[model samples]
Target: MSDIQPRRSYVPPAVRATSEWSWRLLLIVAGVLAAAVALQTVSEIVVPLAIAVLLAAMLAPITQRLARVMPAGAAAGLTVLGTILLVSGLFTLVGTQFSNGFSDLTTQVATGIEQVRDWVRTTFRITDSQFDAYFDQIKDSVGKSGNLGDTATAVGLTATHFVAGIFIALFSLFFFLYDGPHIWGWVTGLFPRAARARVASSGAIAWEQLSAFVRATIIVALVDAVGIASGAAILKVPFAFAIGVLVFILAFIPIVGALLSGSVAVLLALVAHGPGVALIMLAVVVGVQQLEAHVLQPFLLGRAVSVHPLAVILAIAAGSILAGIVGALTAVPLAAVVNAVGKHLFAGESKGEIEQELEENADKDPLARR
Candidate 1:
């Protein structure tokens, strides 16, 4: 009985060697891990590349128009040079204003602190002895824990990192402008022959969407900065130009950026002028933000890369959590590109599924029969 049972079932050696599903699952896990590592590496490298691409894309249309009359190489060169000059000039102007503003702020802060102390003593009937004791404690603590050298070193390190980042970014931008198209072609070619066409098409569409988003964002940021600057100037805010530059930079962050920048403007106004002026500055910020949300965004960004506000917020939050300020700055643009691609690739399948579900529901519903 045992001998007969032993010969009953035969399993092929090939079949027993490995399970297809198990192999597939292992591959999937490996692929996921590889992708995660790749994304981390690419994010670091691609940030500057993305910035350069955005800049190039914004300039491309103008360069193309110029190419109609002049040589393409020359057109690209002229465009890049002009952009550099413009950026340098703007930064120079802002730097000058910032220096002056900082000096004035230092003086104002000293005076403001004195005035506040005097007011507190007179209004609250506080004695000078009480304030002197507080100051003495503060001085003793500060003297024991003096960190002026450490603070200066930390500032120097920050400045060094910033300069290095800027250099890398600019270098990336140069190459991006010069060889971006060729690089795109090479990248697409690396895919399988059957997939190359689709990949190329998708890449082109993504670039288009990214370019549009970048251009629109720049315009919006400029408008917001100018509006805030004008308002701050009117309110006699110290460091108006520096605050305006801050606004411009933050405006790229989407919904929350404007609020933060506006708050800074308001605070500066409050310190420099008064509460009444600060309130007026806040109103100006609100009005500008509203105009941007309703008018500028719709018109400038258009429908090409439109993403839902919820999705934008989620992306921003995720980005901030993952990579701090850089992540937050890049999140919306990444989301826009992802959204564009998702709609492009999956829209038909999603629509088909929806239709099929509806048909099945209708078949089951008594009211549909009626």
Candidate 2:
């Protein structure tokens, strides 16, 4: 009798095609395009939802812990209430300081500008004739402008758009806080059964990374605000409290925001005191920024998520390119989520098969290893 060997089962062309490299690439491209379209269509909806989700994730652990003692719904409600109160108090304080400072700031700035112009004219020997020519050109340009009614209409339209955006953001935040988790579950349910596990896992990882990023950012911003506020107070800078609040808010935008806030602070110092005070304020800003970048950031955010500086800069640029200010604001947290998920997925796949096999064998026979 001839020795017989069993025939191996073969995959049909269609089956192979589904798992081919080209097919995978096409699927990935399709998914990305779909995401881009959805993002564009729902950007106004997405911005506030994203913010609420990040806030919810950051507060979730606290709520969960409180839920063990109280009810989950009550815990969540209390958390939201506390957050509202905190924000309200901060805003009220900042507003009061801003109102007190604004009038004086405006007057001082005007006076300072005039003083500098006079000093320049005296030192540089610039004549009234030269100034007249400049003013004449400015007047001619203004005369050539469109109708004042049209300008007013444009301004009114811009104000309307701004108000509408704020309303949309607030509405979205309410739904996201109350029903975001349920919505996420519903979304995952739409995926195929085989892919649902992966989707859920990725979502959880992304949410966790986003929470970490938000918390880290808040800490950094608070530190910056406190540091700058202290410096301003010591230097007797006008609008110290208001400037601190502005720094706290602007610090959310990272490198660029810090520089802008610092510049404003320096300008204020220049107007309030003199160039010497302005230089000192500039040095203070530089010192605080250096400390934040080298010490505070590494200690606080380094372990939370390890994103490259270049990647962050690029992500901010891309966000600005796509959605302007809103895009820039949201970019880093999104990038952090992407980075965390990418690391988790690719890191597991990169391990050698022999190690995996050995691990599997060890699991199968605990006594065999000994």
The lDDT, on a scale of 0 to 1, for candidate 1 is 0.75
Residue pairs in collision within model 1: none
Error of 1 at 152 (Å): 6.6
Q: C-alpha displacement of 279 in model 2, angstroms?
A: 0.6
All-Cα superposition RMSD per candidate: 10.9, 9.9
Model 2 stretches astray by more than 4 angstroms: 1-38, 118-180, 348-370
- Among these predictions, the greatest TM-score belongs to 2
**Model 2, residue pairs in steric clash:** none
Q: Each candidate: what lDDT?
A: 0.75, 0.74
Model 1 Cα lDDT, one tens digit per residue, 139-234: 999888758999899899967766766666766665555556666667877999866545555565577677778789989999999999998887
TM-score of each: 0.73, 0.75
Model 1 CA deviation exceeding 4 Å by range: 1-44, 110-161, 348-370
